[model samples]
Target: MDDMSENAKSEQYQEKTGRESNPIGVAAVILLLCICFLIDARVGFGALIGAAAGFFAWSLLKDNGTRKEENADDRVAFLDTTVLQHNFPLPQNMPIPYAVLDIRGHILMYNEKFAKEFPNMELILPVVEQLKKAGIGKHAVVVVEEKHYDAMLNQCEVVEENGAVGNVLNMTLVDISKQYELEERLDRNETVIGMLFLDNYEDVMDSLAEDRQPLLSAIVDRKLTQFAADANGVMRKLQMDRYILLLSKGDLETLKEKKFDIMNTIREINVGEHIPVTMSMGVGIGGGSLEDAMQSAKAALDLALGRGGDQVLIKEGEKYLFYGAKAGEVGRNGRIRARVKADALWELMGASSSIMVMGHRNGDLDSLGSSMGICAIARAMGKKCRIVMNEVSTGIKCISEQMAQDEYYQTAFMKEKDALKEMDDKTLVIVVDTHRTSMVEGPSVLEAAKKIVVFDHHRKSAQDFIEQAVLLYHEPYASSTSELITEMIQHIGKRIKLRSIEADALLAGITVDTKNFAVKTGAITFESAGFLRRNGADSIRVRMLFQNDIDSYKAKATAVRDAELYLGSMALSVCPANRENSTLTAAQAADDLMNVTGVKASFVCCKVDDVVYVSARSFGDVNVQRIMEKLGGGGHFTVSGAQLKDCSAEEAKERVRSAIDEYLKEETT
Candidate 1:
């Protein structure tokens, strides 16, 4: 093993010297071995070993000499070179820009290409800091001279002869401006799906003269075709009153810039009819695929139709944008759907073990009346049912007391807490009057119930709807939820009878919501009232229910007396602060102001329990729903109310005025 180690060392020494094994050394060793063999054979072996040891020692000396020579050359190479001389060299003619930055992101050196691209180090300082934060072997995109570049950063060490090292970052930037532009162009050209449905098409056609019908249809088609052509889109007629549209995102942007004037253009076309034609459009963009885009378009179209048509709804991912929601919902031809919904409700009730009916918080006459009507239906269906209510307004206190005296209604009422305790999987919850979960009497009840149903007359909220509803009966054209319930009771059967007081309560609800059947009272509304009348609902009794106490009367009078007029046709009234029954007083004041000639809209603001409430009423020309929505409340186009928590009456009034101003501004624009 020792001989092999010596031989390996000798070979390494020869390699370092850049020379072959010495022939003179080998000849001396061979001659010594020959002399030992001639002198004595036994002693010759020992002499050979000694000679080999001496040759190994001589090879070690030669290896040391070669290493010393190399070290001397390395020292001489650095003797004339400074640390900066070794570090500072620029690739002046390189196409790719490059830079060197110290650990603190201060630029030490840069190539000419980098200097030309970013003449000021200040502009590149942020990029350098970002690259330092990203550490080494990572790329960052940065803009220079209005062009994009992908910069790769690398950390390197500069070693000196003294064994000291300094750290620096080397950045190489490659231009990516053209590639980014290409990607943007492709994105803009991606396809978007849209659906268009003619609003009130059947009604318009029925009203038009037969001879002019075809001409009007042709005109509409030609205009729609022209509209699509102008946007470089494709449109195909899907039905007599519906169209499917496919357009690029770029074309959609152009239409957006035009503010979708096709809606106005179609409305301007007249065919010897009092009602002009209108259309609703729903567009979907930024979906993952064509099928996904089409599904989004379908959802958007459903929203548009549900919002009374003559509008546009655009769906992009989870968000939505709306346009042209100025028109009121068109009256339907009949109440056929109400009968269908009534039968469905009856079936659902029969299958359930018990039913619980609820309404919005601070249960008003309308909400209470609707809840009672549904309870009456549940009783007729032979299902156990209870009305869930924890509080009653002062205005309905007398009626509630009267109902509590009756044997049938003695055990019919339950609080929200009690109702939740008794609930089971077979329990069905019928929510009435209000569809928003925030306004419900008890959201927990709605959340815990396995089967849910909704009956509401208010316009659907764009957000915050009853997502768990299995059956939704929402009719924006109806005057009141009580009216809807009355219709449903009639369809249930003649045998399912409402008590005289129940009838009166339902009739009072319709009267209050419709302002004594003077506003938003359609033929169906009156028919529903007639059904309640036949069941022994007396108008005198209903009127008696609305008769306010002395203090309420005085509060209402004061609110009317303090009326302020604005916008030439609107009246704003504010009730006294900290008054009893302030909500009812404000509503009465608003109704009274609406009676004044030339007062197209009326708003009454009042403070109640740390919250300011505004009761809004309009006379067809103004959309109170839009105004109220601006204040975070929603109802019908002509009647709506809002509650402002922790606000003064004066602040509430100002907010109402501001909402009115904004609404009018939007209308004009």
Candidate 2:
């Protein structure tokens, strides 16, 4: 092996050769191989090849090193890479850019193509840094001077004359710039299908004057026409409330750059008390076929509606991008959908041997009440069902006490293990209050049961949702899952007696989620409450269910007292740990902080065990849901919560503040 290290102790290497004398090194290596051939010594040739490969083995693999020199403890170890090329020679006249690198990623040798492609040695540093960070691969993308190359990195081993061994990297780059350009051209021509639905159209029209109806319809179409024109796309009205859109992938990207401000433009249209019409757009791109794109658009539209409309949702491959959900929903789903869901739930329950109802962990009033409401449905259907409860929280203590006193309820509840043991393929699992797969108390039952049903009022989480449910009833406009369940009982179309305790529990669930009917309440919310009241739901009893003990109350007061006002309108607090009801306490503290004048929103964080819980509340001005969503949480526009793991209480508080900052920044942007 020729000694070509940048820091060779030999006086001949005092100045870098800059490839001026590389041909001489190549010639010397060739002469050695020829001399070995002339001697007709096959054993000697094999030994020489093994020694040359072993030397390279040491140079490239001295130790694992990082691109960031500070993070790498291994000192740079360089060896002659000429011996490596002798063992694995590249074609001298090849048009590809080829080079050899030492263990420290210093380019020791390169061909003419390599010099032409990377005129400056610094240009190759990014490629080397990327390769080191991601590890060497068969084909790696390396971009130099805005040109794309498919690079191949191979390791070579060699042994030096002094018995020292090292490993080096042999790299070859193939220009793929034209291929990428052609792909970009095709993407610019690719068709993307989109659906635009007029959210709250029926309600807005009902409130509009008859004389302005035609003008309002015409204005809506005119605005959409302009929107389509700006993007070089076309739209067709499919119904009074639905429109089909055709756009190119390039056009979609243009809209994305502006965050689809068309949603805001459409909302600003004013027409005789019928102005500010909300629109939801769903775009489907990167589909294999036009039909696939259409199906994807339909699914995206459903997701956008489930998220409360006034937004645009794009589905590309398996990923989703959202924009413009600043406005709240003004309409709840009609009763027809509820009736259809009720019928479907009954059929599924009849098909299963037993049913298991579950809710989120650390059962709250909303979760407990919703599970009991599911039990009421199962009882009406004449099916055996049990509520899965891992532990009780302070919010459900009153209803839990009542449950224990009932003889029929003795076997109605089971722990997670017992539930899993009794569960089988014939069991139908129904989850309430939460749709995220990780939040449920009995996770094993979800996988073991043959069929699963989900009933939730929270906006669907973009990630970690229950995708395996056979039937999912998600209504973001409803006050709580208990409210949805209450509606289901009335429409189940079966005569069954709902015990007073169950009624009280359902009322408590609704009360907690709605904050005693102060926020997130709608016509259906009050209607559901009215139905529960007729079934013997005592308002005084529901109030008692939410009454916290002295310890929890003290924690809430301390958190509120120490709350810091953020950016003038928001409050941030850190609650003391109350394990039995820390989440409940945090939520209460946030709600109490919202009572302060000028405080539009509040966030309360508490550390319970290893998990840091955060509860957020807003008084219609600030959308706490979007802020919490930034921290991997989802809820209504006025109420949301998140839990963080592997972080201290101070860290959690900082994260909440950062999320709030991001939310405010998004507003100004």
Candidate 3:
């Protein structure tokens, strides 16, 4: 039994070391030794002894070799076990889904849970590359099977008998769908604040009889209450013309979907006549706190009111979403604000060492005339002033050329590049006719000046507003920027007299923008024109400033001839390509097309240099500013223009048609 046990242990050791003894060879050698012993007793005995010694030595060397081989095999087995344990520490049947993928995102190994969760799943190569670039050992959110998960990826170096075979990522996924849903729910339920103001409420009330005023007010209040109720919000009347509203994000969404129909509903209510009453709504959303939201609402309300009212503006962080700008601005009968703005302007100008007056690019009659008016004001105040003039169009070329020869006007006008050099820290830059920095003739001068003032009659745009203005006089209700400047001149008092030609220039601006006072002539507009006339502004000279050369007249005729009606009301005309002073020609063409009966609006497209210029005009019914704004331009409701870079005239005409179509579609919807 002892010998059998020893033989079993010896066999087991040999098998483990891969060095099993050769039993047949050993038996043959012993038999041969026995035969030698029988043949010669003495000689055989000696030979047997020699053979036994050699066999013993061979066995010892073989045992040493087997032991060395066994050590090497054990080391290899241990390394394999260590690597397996490091890469896959979890059991195959663990509940948590886990996968092992190579650096390239190829699946190498996966547990049963992972296989069940993502059957035949393959890792996205881009995602894996991103993970590898992120250097692994980090957690990232991933989605699988329409479920959110938090995946923790760990980088691993796989080892084998040779060396490091390759690198792999071990990904463990934790389901986070419930958490994600909860966050979304919280976000949707966040509170939002809003303010609604009845635009020109006092003016409308004053226009109506006392008995009718109460009826208009009551109707407006009731409609507002209904609007708030529809959105499941709370509304409180803040004043005779304003209300405060509180709602949730979801409620705001509902209100947006309805397009805030209260604006149109209020307009429909007639207090004995077409009162043209409208409301401006300002909403604040995604604010961090109630106070923040309230502040945002107030800012939005100011913006809406500044932009001619009759619109809905939603403030979300740094961005804004606008709706309902269908109606033209209600002309204001009061000049109280104009006087106030003039006083503010006087103080700002007084504080400056010098004043730089600038207008929009390609200075037109309105831009140039408005700049001249402001410069006149600065000269009256006994302050050094410079008018930054870059490009002059033919519409204002006669006046500009005449002014250039005059000593006083020569000193007044300066090139944009010189204007920048002349500006200093105490210089006040008054941007006239345009409030946008991008449209200013000398943007560098605007940037260099420490004090800034803006006087514009165009509607305010959220994207292109003067951020650094000390005083901004924007009256969209006024006919023209020149009209606003004229009002300021009158308010500045009679001592600040405008020269005969200066008055003519200001009148020319008003004439161009108002289409010779045939459109958008409000009470204030007439008052400003009257003031200019009293100061010796000649109507004939202003009319001559609007006359075009023979080529320009022919270009205008061509544009008018090519006019095609769109949506049955909008006339779209594409001028002949590459004409001199095409912008001026296109604008004249658009004005001429509007003369055609039944045309609500006219858009003329022309090409100059590499830009496509579009001039838009409307007749009280269509809001051309809103349409032009969509194409990165802005102006008054009845008159607006846009410049398209790197676009052909034909392409611009098509875009104009699309814009008109979109406007019509939205109006109907």
* Candidate 3 deviant stretches above 4 angstroms: 1-90, 93-95, 101-109, 115-146, 151-155, 161-164, 167-169, 563-571, 596-600, 620-622, 654-669
> Best candidate, lDDT-wise?
1
Off by over 4 Å in 1: 1-109, 119-176, 209-212, 557-574, 592-605, 620-622, 646-669
lDDT of 1 by residue, 325-426 (tens): 767776665468889999999999999988999999878889889988988887786776798888877768878998989888888888889998999999
Candidate ranking under lDDT, highest first, comes to 1, 2, 3
Q: What TM-score, computed on C-alpha atoms, does each candidate reach?
A: 0.77, 0.80, 0.80
Tell me which of candidates 1 and 3 scores higher on lDDT.
Answer: 1
- Candidate 2 lDDT over 1-669, as tens digits, reads 355553364444323222123688657777877777778789558757975896557434442222234222222233434454554455667799988887778887888888888889988888887877767765788788889988877787755443445677878889999998999899898999999999888778888988988888899999998999999999899999899999899988899889998888888888777647899988888769999999889878888888888888999877888888887765745799898998898889889988999999877888888888888877877887899887876667777888999886778989889988887778889999898988889887777878899999887776788988999999888889998888888897547578899999999899988888998889889998999999999999888877888988888899999999878888989999745788888898998998899998998999988989889988767888889989888788889888899998889989988998888887776
lDDT by candidate, in order shown: 0.84, 0.83, 0.82
- Superior candidate under TM-score, 2 versus 3: 3
True lDDT of residue 420, candidate 2: 84
List pairs with backbone clashes in candidate 3. none
Better of 1 and 2 by TM-score: 2
- The TM-score of predicted model 2 comes to 0.80
> Where's the lowest-lDDT run of ten residues in candidate 2?
66-75
